[model samples]
Target: MASTVSIGNGYGQLLRTRGAWTYLLPGFAARQPFAMLTISIVLLVQHTTGSYGAAGAVAAVTGVSMALFAPWSGRLADRHGQRAVLIPGVLGHTASGLTLTALALAHAPLWALFAAAVPTGASVPHIGPMVRARWGVTLKGSPLLTTAAAFESVTDELTFVVGPLLATALCTTVNPAAGLVTEASLTLLGGLLFAARKSTQPPVAAAGHARVEHASALRVPGVRVLIVAFLGIGSVFGGMQVSLAAFTESLGEPGLNGVLYGTFAAGNMLSGLVCGALAWRTAPQQRLVVGYGALALTASGLWAAHSVLVLAGLGLLVGMCIAPALITGYTLVESLVPAGARTEAFTWLTGAVALGQAAAVTAAGQLEDHLWGGSGFLVPMGGTLLALATLLALRSRLAVRPRSRTVARGVGHRVPVAVD
Candidate 1:
């Protein structure tokens, strides 16, 4: 628990954080479209190639490349601030995407295609990492932290919900490569917007290098555990990306793919809103465990839904857990990490999830194509269940056990974290 002053159960503390919301607007706008581009790239390539395995390979390459670069990018951002790092990254992403799009249209060779994937992965800015790092710095232990996190989560879910559907429509009904053009243009615009703002500047340490407390955050046990947890989270998302769309098409209802995806995203957005509105009332670890449990149950229940309507409703229920777990994990990072390493900490968390999503998509892409598309969803569901089980088992290991930590803080008494 934050052990901080409690306002009456509303997130009034968040609402009162005057300058907070506006600073985030540009970021939300930029990310909303970028997140959609990820799906657009994945589905467009998969559909165009008629090979899920090929699509997964490309996605995997993207994930691996991005994951490899993410930590270093964060470190650079921390050292040089957002302008120095993000602008170049945004340009890099735009150039790379445009090059690849042009090359694809020209019917380029496979070698160039694979080469282009490297930039595609490398140029993708570490937005989640940077945004969260900014939140950690500005909000400290306030409700603004929770709200910012929830806000990001909602944007994340909503972006995927709306972004993909729009991209899909453009690809199917308009131009097969229309989404690529949009992705590139938005990357430039968003990256430029992020760079334009003076107030939203990222922090840099005195050392002028983001190395001081950086490595230590990586070594934290809980951090590692949480990172591992997101592996399943990534798989869930990856599976959903391919399978949900494919399943709808398989059922001879290709149009419903958009509805299903939108519904799933809606579920996540709704939950993020609900979770954000609730006052912080539970321990981060406890909240995380419960969130994963609910997520697992939702994932499992999704498998048994008998119809699209039932599936959509159940998917919404499952999506509800997305933001809460992330919010809880982020809080834990802030609670446990040294201030100096916050950027790196945030980077690892976001990058790790990205990597997981990439890996899941790569790992399961073939299976979905060769076997049952619905079968792919099982991978994520299983991963979420396993993640839930691991979290439960690690409870004793990670839990603060009231007396031990509270005794350290010497807070004499414990306060109930109120909801409602």
Candidate 2:
């Protein structure tokens, strides 16, 4: 009877955690644009410019810009609060998307497309980090925080799954610009809805506060290690995306790319949901190591896949480790950073992933152009292996425990205790 009760409680944690679903749903909506933007840009640019190299360059530039700005954006949110930072950011990002779409439809110059892409990327609202920060504030000191992290990871996987499929369908059916337009609309609408929820927003830190005296989250001992590891993981995602697209085109079925990528995310979503529900005694670092190992093992199989079916099957296995790893990483970040720095900390992590992805995408694009077929898979394989190595090397530093104190001194308020 005790075991049954514990199992039921574990699965019911998400529902039991008040306001989790409320914030999480809009967060999921806001994040759809992130998943859709890359593919949409690629399709739009490729169609207009008639060169995969140019398309890849534009996508890489956009990713790099977003990565470069994410931590700064997060810092602003930390100081000024979510609505203050996100509302303007979302508006600028949406406007940039509209500009890009117009440029693409008008058959503008390559330089014009690249020019418009900068603001689109720079204005990305770092919604993922903000959402996770809210979770930290809401569920502090509870075991259920882990479950919330898992749910967020599943939300990410689901968004990536749906976003890509939706973008592909729009691009294929309506027009190349349709996906970008849709992405802009979603970003504007969802960002406003998410920001309007005043009850759930985490409080801003006071200006010139001494709590902000501590150096950035980058200086936190374990954070740099996790950021580096996440960079590697991001490379795996970026490389896989480019490689899979190229692989499908080579197979004479370019449309299958979205379905194959969605299948990958589907595997991630399934594992994340299951991992979140079960109670685990293992330390997050141990789980992280195991996750990286799984990713490396599965990703290495890509080199051997000669058939589309085999590649799709391998994609599912490779993706299974993604959510578990990401969930563990974010949970660790929550435990490590001070309350005042949580949003910035999470954004830095997001930026690391973007940096890794940008680098890998550029490299994979080049490899696809020059190397033999399927050789591009090596980029992600190498990245996962590097991530595994980093985790193993820094295992000791990441051993910090979750703080149990309830007062959120950094945010100048108390996080309400979760009531069953």
Candidate 3:
């Protein structure tokens, strides 16, 4: 009973945190469309063009566009505020989605489809970083900030789990256009709702603020190393996705792809919540190292599994390390960068993940096409090994000694004064 009460208190703390749900819910909703967008585009383009090659090309372009533009959007939010950036970004993104859908329905030329995809991808609002920046501001200097980061990680897992399933269902049953249209509608509604919550938004730094011109977060001691580590981690996800699809197809149950993928995400979501609830004795950097090592170990299990059931079970096991790594990674970024550039720093992390996933997916697809079953799974295992190596080699740069209470208090009390 005592343990039960403690668990309940953890949840209570999450709920009572001011404006937590208000910012998080819409952020969660908005991210679903992004999660849905790539798969929907692939399905839609394939259905119309009858060419998986065409579909893959368009999806790759979309992914690249979003990865390139996300940091720019985040930089604008850091300067102009989330509301200023998100509203226009979301609107343009929605408009682009609509245009793409219209083109698809009208049987427009393949070149036209690719052209519309550029803006649709480029206009994504960087919702992940925006919500996280809000949490950083609201929960600064509090232990609960770790929990909040974990919550966001869980939201990411859930979005990936649900979004693809929903997109697949809509594309297969209703129509390909239906999936894209739903993504657009959700983006508009969720973006507007998220933008409307101005009170929780982080205060923007003035244009002329000296700190706004501070050296890029990439210049921070361990940030570049962290980014590289995250890129490898992202490849783990991308490779697993493609590997699972190939694995399921070999089982003659291609439709079960969503189920298998969701199972992986479910493991991530569950582990994130549990990891967040516990008090950690280790520092964030240490936890991050452990997470990477564990991921590599678990991912290697894929080599032993020949059947779908065994593969799915191993996926769940591998997923357990994902959230802990991501939560620690984001928390480390927060500690490394100045407050003025937090959003952009976070978005860079997001973009790195996207690019890594894109690269891995492309490579994994080729391997699956040429090699025997389960061989493609080696890619993620290799990625996790690379991540572990990078983290260990650069571990010294990520260290953060605990601050004295007096210094912590003094730093916490400083207000954001405008600079000329």
Candidate 4:
């Protein structure tokens, strides 16, 4: 509790430097509630239709829509902004949700799946990365942005962990249709609030260089490398969810599954908060390396724990490192990126995470089919992830080229690096 307080104080001080904390509050509140609703929508659709196939189609279409259009949508956000870009995206999602409820209830198929998911695809994600970039631009050199990233990670973990559970409760206890309606209303309301705010608008790129700038942003070596890293990390974490499911069921403690998962999440939350609070001297690059290295180490440690309790505890410890690392990674994307690409940059970060998580879950499930149980399944799985993380960390210098190296050649002064 003391540590949490300390962290909050540190974060508050950092935000004070910008004097724009209030400006971001509305966006933050709006974002998390919408995420909860999105998850609920998936669960509700599955329940109402009584077909996992229909449900899966919805999830797939929604996911694919985001992956395909995220970069471009982000580009739009960067160009047109919160009012023009984000609001339209939000409106699309809201209208789609309303229409989909009717179409789904009517038993529409095929093209309807695409139609229903289009709006969910088009909307900007919860404002985590964009907010970080805005802070980076407005409060240049202040640590407030990193602290905000930490806070964003906290909300992310919480929203994901709590969201499905809340959905399940609503569907099972109340009318399933009501649950869907609740989800729709929340998403529409929250997103509208987010776009309506003035400060929520992201920073602008310099004049006459928007299109050329967006293209060049992709060409950035640092961006490409970071994306690769995101893929590996996201895949592993995503797969771990699947692995956990297999492990609990195989251990003949299916009831313990939720408990184990809860602990895993608790660990992530604790670690993220603690790490974010620590006033570190390490460069963001070094912090990023340390962050991944911690995950790799924890992966192996998790494999070694013999019981659920021990594993849960270690998972929490490992999770502590996750948010700070993510914060560092997002900061890297924000710093090296040009002004025009902030929206796109944030989306790329999230999309990378989404891609990795999706791949990991699929691969893990396949691997589990060939294994005895989850315990047997996760060992090899953890090993693979740990090895990859280690390799990436070792080669990070090559993969993540710091800006300072260039500064040394061009100027005598040390160039600032924002990653750790």
Top candidate by lDDT? 2
TM-score of each: 0.86, 0.91, 0.87, 0.75
Question: What Cα-based lDDT does every candidate model obtain?
Answer: 0.69, 0.80, 0.77, 0.57
lDDT of 2: 0.80
Residue-wise C-alpha lDDT for candidate 2, range 145-213, written one tens digit per residue: 877788778888899899988997898678988899999988998898899887889886555552442
Give each prediction's root-mean-square deviation over alpha carbons.
6.2, 4.9, 5.1, 5.9
Residue-wise lDDT of candidate 3 within 1-420, one digit each (tens)?
Answer: 001125466667876987778877888889976578876776677678775445656666676778788778887788788899999988999999999889987889878887998899888777888888888888778777777787788888888789877887787678878879999988998999999999999887655673543335555656777787778777776677667766776787766767877888889889888876777777888888888899989987786689878888988988887888888888887776677667888888887777676666666666776777777688788888987888899898888644221111132343232221
TM-score of 1: 0.86
Error of 4 at 392 (Å): 2.4
- Which scores greater on TM-score, model 1 or model 4? 1
Cα lDDT, model 2, residue 189: 85
Q: Which candidate, 1 or 2, would have the higher lDDT against the true structure?
A: 2
Candidate 1 lDDT over residue span 93-166, tens digit each: 88888776776667676567568878888878766666777667667666477677776677677777877787
Candidate 4 lDDT over residue span 222-331, tens digit each: 56656655665555455445555455655766445445545555666666777668666666766676567776666656555666777677656655655666666676
Q: Mark the regions of model 3 whose C-alpha exceeds 4 Å error after superposition.
A: 1-5, 46-54, 102-112, 207-214, 373-375, 401-420
Considering TM-score, where higher is better, how would the candidates rank from best to worst? 2, 3, 1, 4
